[model samples]
Target chain A: MKEGTSISVSKLTKRFGHFTAVDAISFDVKEGEIFGFLGANGAGKTTAMRMLCGLSMPTSGEATVAGYDLYKQSEKIKKSIGYMSQKFSLYEDLTIKENNRFYGGIYGLSDKQINEKTEFMLHHLHLEDQANTLVKELPLGWKQKLSFSVSMIHDPKIVFLDEPTGGVDPLTRREFWTMIYEAAHRGTTVFVTTHYMDEAEYCDRVSIMVDGKIEALDTPSALTRQFKVQGMADVFVQLARKAKRSDN
Target chain B: MESIQVDHVDKSFQSGKSPVEALKNITFNVKQGELFGLIGPDGAGKTTLFRILTTLMLADKGDAWVDGYHVVKDYEQIRKRVGYMPGRFSLYQDLTVEENLSFFATLFNTTLEENYELVKDIYVQIEPFKKRRAGALSGGMKQKLALSCALIHRPSVLFLDEPTTGVDAVSRQEFWQLLRGLQKQGITILVSTPYMDEASLCDRVALMQNGSIMKIDSPGGIISQFQKPLWAVQGDNMYQLMHDLRHDSRVDTCYPFGQYHHVTFNESTIDIESLKKEFQQKGVHSITIDRTEPTIEDCFMELMNQ
Candidate 1:
C-alpha cells in the first residue's frame, strides 16, 4: 500500500449468491488524491463503491477505508467520508437549505456547524438565489450540484462522487470538476466513479473495473501510452474489446 | 423564407408563488435540408422550443413554423411535417418493435408499406427482434425503435432532444449514423445534446444556455472562432501541471482533456518559449508543446463566458 493511503484492499471480493459483483480486487487510494473508479453500466463499480463506503458487506476479504476497518469499523468509516450516488439522494420536497440540514443532521453535525456549512455550500455553488426553492423545482443540473454540495455538509475527509456530473452541460461539468480539484488541493481525497471516459482521464489515477475485476490501473497517460491508444476512451475500448474476445 | 422559424416565442409556468419563465423571446430559424442543433443544458428551453415546434405544446406569445406550417394555427400540418423523439424514451414498452412502427405510422393516417423505405435501414437491425417487447430490448435497440417510429410518418423535419444521454458510446455513434442517413434524404433535423463532441456531427448548431442562443453556426465555423491559442501540455507531474497552469497569467483556460491538459493563452500576448521555460522550472520534464485546435466544448465554454 502507498504511504498514508486513505483506502486499501486485499483479496476484496463481493458476491450475491451465485453472482460475484466484486472479485478479489486490490488497490490503494493515496491521501489527498483524486482516484477514479471507471466501469460501464453494471460493471460492478457501484458494488465495489458500496463495499468501500460501508453501505454493503463484502462476501470476503480485507479492506480499509478512511483508516477504518471495512468489517468492524464501518461506523467510523461512514463518519469520516461522504457519499453521493447516481440518485440525488436529497429530499425533493425540501428546499435546498432544508435538504442540507437533513443530510447534515444524519451525519451527526452540530446545528451550528450545519448552518455554517450550508451557507458555504450555497455561496460556493451560486445557489444563494435558489436557497429557498424546492429541490424538485430546480432544474436537473442545479439539483445535481446542490446534492453534491450536500454530500459534504458534515465536513468529511473524503467524498465518494458516483457519476455526479451525469447529464449536466459541459460548462457545469467543468465548474464541478474545478470544485473537485479545489477539494483535493485542500487535503481531501476524492474517490469518484464515472462512465464518462473523458472525465476518468482527469483523475490522478484511474482503475477500470470490468466483470468485478480491476482490468487496468494507471494514470490516464500511462495507460493510454501502454495500450498504444490516444485517449482514455480508446484505452477503455481496447480493454473492453479484449474482454469480449476472451469471452468469445 | 425560413425553413423553420420561432418568432418571439415565450412560455411560462404558474409556480404557485409566482410565475416562472421557461422561455423568453426565443427566436431562431433553420434552413431546409440543413441539420441544425439546439445545444443546451437540461431545462434550458431546448425541450420547450422542440415541444412547440413538434406541436406537443403551445407557445404563449408568438408562433413557430415547421415546413412553412404555423405551429398553433396549423397544428395538424405542423404535426404531419415534424418527427419528434423526446429526450425520454416514450415508446410503447409492451408493444413489439414492428407494432410500435405500425402504430406511429397509423397516427399520421399512413401505412408501413407507404413509408417502409424511409425506416428500412434502421428497422432491419431490429427486424430480428420484431416480436420482442420494446422494453426487453437494449438501450440502443430502444433508441433505434424510437427513431424508426418517428420516421414512419415520413416527416419532412425531425427533432431529437438529448437523445443519447443514457446510451453507450457505440449506441450514440450508431444513432448519429442513422440520423445522418435520414438527413441525406432531404429532411431537416434539429437535434439537441449536452455532449459537445456530438456538436460536430450537426451541420449547424445554436448553443443555447439559460433560455438564449449563445452562438449559432456550423460546428467548424463556431470552433474556428474560438479566441485563444490552445496547447496540450503534459509532463511527469500532471496534478501539479494543472494546478500551476490555472494560476499562470499566460494561461487563459486550462482543462484536462484526455491525457494532457489543454491550455489556452491570450491570443494577443502568448509566449510559448517562456511558458515552456516556466513549466521546466517547476520540475516538470518531458513537456511536449503543440498548437491545439479548439473543440466544440472549448467553443461552448467560450460562448458561455461571453
Candidate 2:
C-alpha cells in the first residue's frame, strides 16, 4: 500500500481452467483519479474487474483496493467500494425513493441518515416529483442517472462503473460524465469501463486491455502521442485489432 | 421503387393504468439498395417501428409495406423477403453456431450450400467454432452468428436494430463495413443505433425522439444545417471551466466533447481568440479554443434543445 494510492495491482491475474482470462497485469490508481478500463469484447476486462471488486478471486497477483488487501480483506474491499453496470444496477420494479432507501440500508446506514440522504439525492436530481415513480417508468437516461446516484448513497471510497453511459442520449451521456467528474472531485476514486472512445479522453489515465494483458497505459494525450494516432479511437482500433481471443 | 414504406404509423402499449405512445404518426421510406438508419436512443420507438415493418407487430394506425408487400395483409410475403437482427441476440442458445444457421436455412426451405456466398464473409469469422454453442460464444461472435442466421434466407431487405449498441468501436466499425458490403450487393439495409457517431456511416438517417421523427437527412446534410458557431475549448480544469462557460453570456450552449468542451455561440462572428482571452481573464487558465466542425452528436443535441 502507498500513500494517496486508492488502488494498486501488481501482476494481478485470473485463470479459468486452461484459459488465462486476465494475464499478469499491474497498475496503480491514485486517490480521486478517474481510471478508464478499456478493452474490446471478450478481452478479459470483466474478469479483471471482478477480481478487484472481490466478486471473483484472483488466481495469482497482489492487489489492494481502498486500503484493503485483495486476498485477505475482500469482504472489507467490497464494503469500501461501489459498483454499477449498465446491465444491472437498480431494481426496475421499485420506486425511485424505495430504491435509494434500499441501497442506503444495504450499506448499513441508519434510518435517519437514509431518509436525509434520499431527500438530498432526489433534490439534486430534480426527481422530487417522481419519488414514488417506479424506476421502470422513468426514461432510460433518468434511470441510469438515478442508478449512479443510488450507487453513491453510502459514499464509498471508489466507484466502479461498467459502460455506465451506454444507450443514453448524447446530452444525457455528457451529463452522466459530469456526475462522474463531480464524484471524483469529492475524492471518490472512479474506476470506469466504457465502449465509447470519447469517454476515454475524460479519464486521468487509461489502461487498454488486449488478449488479457494491458497493452497500453498512459494519459490520453500521452497515449495519442506515443501511438502517433489522431485520437483514442484510432489507438484503440490499432491495439484491439491484434487481439487473438475474439472467441471468448 | 421503395424497398420499405411506412405511412403515418402509430403504436402504443398499455403500461399500468395509462397508454404509453410508442410511435406517433411515424412515416419514413427506404429506397432500394439504400442504407437507411433509424438513429435514436432507447424507448424512441425504433424497435416498435422495426416490428411493424417486419410484420411481427401491427400498428394501430396507418400502413407499411416491405418489398412492395403490405405489412399486415401480405405479412407472409414481407416475412419471406425481410431479414431482422434484433437488438438482443435472439438465437437458440443451446444450438451450435452451425446448427442455428442450418435451422434458419431449413425454416426458409433453403440449404446452407445454396446461400453460402451471402454470409460467407461473416460466417467464416465464426466458422472455426461452428461446433461451439451459441451461449458459450462471446459478444462479438454471438452478434455474427445472429447476423448469419438473419441472412440465412437471403432476404431482400435487412432490418438491424441497434446492432452496434454495446459493441466496441473496432467491432462496430467492422459491422458497419459488413453492412456496406451487403448494401453493395443490392440489399436494402435498415439499421438503428444509439451511437451518434454511426450516423455518418448511413446513406441517410432518421433521427427519432419520443416516438416521433425529428429529422431525416444524410449525415453531411444534417451537419451542414447546423446554424450555430461551434468552438472546441480545452482548459486545465474542465469541471470549473464548464460551470463558468455555462453561466457566461457569450456561450449559448456548452457540452463536453472528447478532450474539449464544445461551446456554441449565438454570434457567428465570435472570435476564438477573444473568447479564449475572456475565459482566461475569468481565472480559467491554460485555455485553448478552436473552431470545430459540428458532429452528428452536436446536431443531435442541437435538435434536442429545439
lDDT of each: 0.82, 0.91
Which residue window of length 10 is worst by lDDT in model 1 chain A?
A239-248
Estimate, for each residue in B51-150, the C-alpha lDDT of model 2 and write its tens digit. 9899889799999989999998999988888899998899999999989988999999998789888898999999989999999998889999999999
Error of 2 at B246 (Å): 0.6
Instruction: Encode model 1's per-residue lDDT on B184-203: one tens digit a residue.
Output: 99888899887778889998
Report the C-alpha lDDT of model 1 over A1-248, residue by residue, as the tens digit.
Answer: 45679899998998888877788999998888899987654567778888889999999999998888999999999999988877778898999888878888898888999889988888888788888888888877777777777887777888999888776877678668878888888888899987667788889899987777889999887998899977888777666644331110
- What does TM-score give for chain A of every model? 0.94, 0.98
Off by over 4 Å in 2: none
Give the DockQ (C-alpha) for candidate 1: 0.36
Q: List pairs with backbone clashes in candidate 2.
A: none
lDDT of 2: 0.91
